[model samples]
Target: MHLAHYLGLLHRSQANLASAFREVAAAHADEPDIEHLCLRQAAICDTHAERLHPFAERYAEEAPREPDRLHSTLFSGTRTGGIALLRDLQDLYLMASECDICWTVIGQAAYGARDRDLLATVRDGEGETAAQLTWLRSRMKQAAPQALVVAD
Candidate 1:
């Protein structure tokens, strides 16, 4: 497949993932901690989609489409109990990792084509996403319940 096709896929996947997170966030909105984290994560995904939209328009043969399978799988995976919360956080981490992979591939392709503008834009977006992931990690750490101390 062409680079544009791959980038478009990534963009759609990011958007779909964000939408799934938003759904989960809405479900858990009463829980302030989880809700805040989910909202932040949803914002990051929205930002990623926005950043990739221009590239998709310029490079792709058509507009990006939603990644239905990924979205469905993510939603199904998070449809449980406390397990869902943990799964949601894990999914966010996985999505962030995928974003890094996509950025690396796109950046390499842009460098090979001598496309400085694309490279710069993708790199900046990647950096922001990475930072957001770091923030999410910190939030996850905070959200994790402390282990009970056992009596000897």
Candidate 2:
């Protein structure tokens, strides 16, 4: 059914998030914590996508053609300086939030379909996604003071 469409959406979104993480990590390499955490989160996104692949393929046979414009770009690229770091983290927060919601929806679908494997994957991924959001939020809060208030 429409589950395939969402599976595809989540898959692509995970890939996009991973790439954006790597890009931001590299762009802000000066910030060691940001770089390390971004890299770790990128790996987590990759694992989530890998887990979803078999399910996406299995349901595709029953799924209608995917809808157009199902995907949106959240992070174009990273920018420079303190404020830019905050903005980039905000972009990541938005992207991770998308993945978080998708995981919830898909988890519900898995429960309906009686798919234990998918449910477990969703549960695990959702927790990690939540952690990513938390870290992003905290980092943004830390950056805001310097980015918005303190002089260069």
- TM per candidate comes to 0.77, 0.90
Model 1 lDDT tens row, 31-112:
6776777777778778878877877877863434446665666566445555455556666676667667778888888888
TM-score of 1: 0.77
- CA lDDT, every prediction? 0.70, 0.83
Ten-residue region with minimum lDDT total, candidate 2: 61-70
Candidate 1 regions exceeding 4 Å error are 61-67, 77-80, 146-152
RMSD of 1: 3.8
**For candidate 1, which ten residues in a row score worst on lDDT?**
143-152
